[model samples]
Target: MEISSPPRSNATDLLVSTSSDISHLTELLTAAGLELGPGGTDAHRPPRRVLNTPRYAAMQARFDRFGSDGITMMCSTAGLQVCLDMGERDRVATRWAALHALGPVLLAVFANSARLGGRSTPWVSARTRAVLGTEPARTRRGAVSGDPAAEWAARVLDTPLICWRHGGPDWTAPPRVTFAEWIGGALPGVPTTEDMDYHLSTMFTPIRPRGYFEVRYLDSQPPQDWMAPVALLIALFEDERVVDEALAAAQPAVGRWLHAARVGTADPRVAGAARAVLDLGLRSLPRLGLPTDLHDEVTRSLDRRLAAVPAPHGGDLR
Candidate 1:
């Protein structure tokens, strides 16, 4: 599933093809005790041990404390997670901010989960709703300003620890204990650099920038449509001018997370923003070096949605 150099001419096809191959292999294995598993955003089935790993067991125990919302996200939700390189050093902050700014537009366009527990829900993406309901200290995006790395560092230190991995199965940290507190000797043991690295891994912000940007806002699409969104993302960030255009197009809907997940494209501002970005992505496909057939595939898939968005309105999505 690794693309050594991403956005390669057939990168989207490569990813989708790889995913299908894995799914086929998984289907064969399901003849044993395993099942291919549920799709969409949420399935209301009660949590069970799918993997018997120690870290997973410990993390599940911690999530249980956050109530139904946290538990629901931990056990029931899945997404189409995209990881992109941070790009050049100088433009990294700009790219990071642009992605966050465009999040609502992209999310609105791709919102797929409309039901939970076998009943229809109001939200377009119930998966996002579940995440919003989870503990904000860990789940929400970090404030972006000044230095991207510094802001992220401060945010990480300020977040409450989910669990501290001890050799035993009970990797629970004391309630409400922040990592900064641990560093300042507020807890019994001295924390090390390794502990900090593990703590970084525990934070679940929407756009996590490790060595690369881990885009987590998009919902899981139906199998046939997954490639479209990936292609759109590749095109949107194809160059700096397009990135700026994207940011401007999405500005009206920026930070409107609740609106995006609820009504999605039904919200006029969100719809307009989505349309603008979709147009930009489609046009940029040629410059992206995608094959003519792939360009046509992405365009056809996205154009249907574009045709549905209303023209831009002055009202704020929020």
Candidate 2:
């Protein structure tokens, strides 16, 4: 289902609506000689195992230009699709900047991916680090501007174009060519505005812009514990006063995305801010009137994080 406006959208209602839909989907998949893989059930499974068909090969080939080399039949990574409702259009850019800033702490709090190539990986969220390790500029935290659309438009043009459609055997771009340069008659024919928009989608960042602010850093969690991060996100942003406190709490950890992904909560600064953010989310639970059971589950998830932080060489939480 689609949730265009989440604040204006009812969480309970959306859950009721989507639960049945998900169930139906599960049944259909089961009937189609397919089954749920050990993804959410197990953290060690490959996050993105895709079917290597020609279409997928082309897609992976494009990513290969960046730096990805894995072979599988279907893509499989799961994470909460979180969107914070910001009511006014006028302040979107400013609000987006604020949300974008909170990304590192969130990544630390929900750093769940501990596996790569079906075995334990060094990074707390190896999935995230691996993605960031790709074409550096495009994979890091995205840019923020006072005017989001305008800034995003500029970012799309300025970032290097990965590959474009053509009747050639190779889709690789010329060295040091950017979409902006292409627009100015650099190499291949100038692309349309729609093409530029498509290029923006290819770039990955913590915060992806939609009508509601989308946070993309949280890793795929255990199926039972997935809702906590989503709740944390909502509780932090649902009220203006809470938003201010959370932002201030996250100040020290700002721009520390790589650190957060690597160290998880063991990084002292991220741990402190994460504790504050988790505590703040707990405080807002009553006020927001979210489902008690789900919120309680979220509380348990946060409690585990506070009690144990991932160590660099050891997988044991302490």
Candidate 3:
């Protein structure tokens, strides 16, 4: 399941592919019996009540084999996560565009891991919850609006460094200190400009607007379905019409990111946006030469989730 590198180009027309590296990681884990079930166990049972040692051993063995590298594992502070390489020049812009466009689609595609603590957590994507909980600056933010590169750079420079890996726990600083502050000599240490730059690189948010915006929001979708989000994102960005339509449809759910992340497709606004986005996606799929069946699958899933929204206790939609 090795993911090939994307074609070398900053052209909007380039079809951005989903990295197979993540697929390999997930498959290895699953093959080793590390099933990503709701709460990591079956219904009517407490989570982690039954540990599978052999499965864990297999996973450890696999990890030991591949090991780590810069491109292989970015932002160790945010955990070993795979980030798409969008070349050098427009890295942040391309990453941001891909992330924002693909966020909801990925969320829909990888809507497994619904249960937590051996109980349904009302979210269809609990793995996403675990990701966002990784670090504040990296995973907490909502969508971005404006030039991707400048915005990303500004945000990164302003976000305080949570910790420097070198200094350990003793290197901690005031909670609100920004990278700018550290560079301005506000901290005890006479931090260099290079230190500021390095610190900025570590911040991870769901939709980072760095040189290439990274979509850190999706759960580990099934390997087979991995291409769905990638395809949807490429189509949406490459086609201006699709981008406009998706933006229009997702507007209602703009400020409700927290609600969406918390309850997933359960919330009416989130569900509505999901439906709109899928419908728009289906209409644009033909232009991209992608199979209509994929769009249909997305549409059906959204419809099913929307229909499953529980009736209000008092019969009110609110």
Candidate 4:
């Protein structure tokens, strides 16, 4: 598929959200006869017919056909790829801005498998669980560092690969083989730095800092809901005051990342975090020149989801 890059300013930063089991979700899309590329899965893909032209009509048609299957619409600005660009001092800041900005938007846009095991799951976002289950280092929320690029590079070197897609078959590497190991001749191909970079790209995580940090932890939301997260992210990050508010709001629930994904809005901690984040997002919306209604709707949805389900057991939510 030809992926058209968004405007440079918009595409510079990226946020990735994945279903609980993205591989399975990809399979689902394939079964539905849709091909997903590096961008998103199934209905989430930009309509093939609309490339290089107005997307409104085609986007609407795709939504009409498959929006209810829990397809999420995400945004990526051209700015995100600048990590590969040299002479950028504010690269990490831009990435954090994107991530912080996208948090609530992601929450709002979240749509995922409502059913699992051939039955309707109580949670509206089962994809969150699926992605969480895939890998811990990549999906789990780690300590956000001051420099996302450096932090991501260091972490990438440490995270072991789940599987490597070689030609036609996936060669399963040792679970403990870190990027550092591969780079330092552990894998024995005298891997180059470029190869190491490519390897890092393959390790899917919630907060990854390559050329850009991909926030791969959200369930696909409806198409109409796409702009909410995009707008929210841009607002929160670009504006200093909004960033402060967001961090404050996110702090309360920072510890609940696992619970939020595992039990979603059900876990009280997760609920609290959702509420806090939503509250902050609403307060900041006006300042960012975005709509507060989006914030309100998202907050309401999370509240309802939390109230309806009981928290799951185990070692934190995915």
- Which candidate has the highest lDDT of all? 1
TM-score-better candidate, 3 vs 4: 3
lDDT of 3 by residue, 1-318 (tens): 234455534322232333345556667878897643322112344322133343233322322333321111221112112244444553434445544654654464346556544467665655555555545455466445456566666777777665543354344445667777876876767777677655765665666433343556655444444445554555555555556677777664555544565666556665666767666655655565544565566446444544554432332112
Residue range 221-247, candidate 4, lDDT tens digits: 443333444444454555555556666
Model 4 residue runs over 4 Å out of place are 1-5, 8-111, 146-150, 162-175, 286-318
Estimate, for each residue in 250-316, the C-alpha lDDT of model 1 and write its tens digit.
8877788889989998888788778778888888877766677776887898998788777766665
- After superposition on all CA atoms, how large is the RMSD of candidate 4? 11.7
Q: Considering every candidate listed, which one attains the maximal TM-score?
A: 1
Q: Candidate 1's C-alpha lDDT?
A: 0.77
lDDT score, residue 225, model 3?
A: 43
Q: Looking at model 2, which ten-residue stretch has the lowest summed lDDT? A: 69-78
lDDT of candidate 1 at residue 307, scale 0 to 100: 86
Q: For each candidate, what is the lDDT?
A: 0.77, 0.64, 0.50, 0.46
Reference-based lDDT, residue 60, model 2: 61
The alpha-carbon lDDT assigned to residue 159 of candidate 4 equals 79
- The local lDDT score (0 to 100) that residue 223 gets in candidate 1 is 57
Stronger candidate by lDDT (3 vs 4) = 3
lDDT of 2 by residue, 224-280 (tens): 466667767777777777777877878767778878878877777777777777777
The local lDDT score (0 to 100) that residue 263 gets in candidate 2 is: 84
Candidate 3, backbone clash total: 12
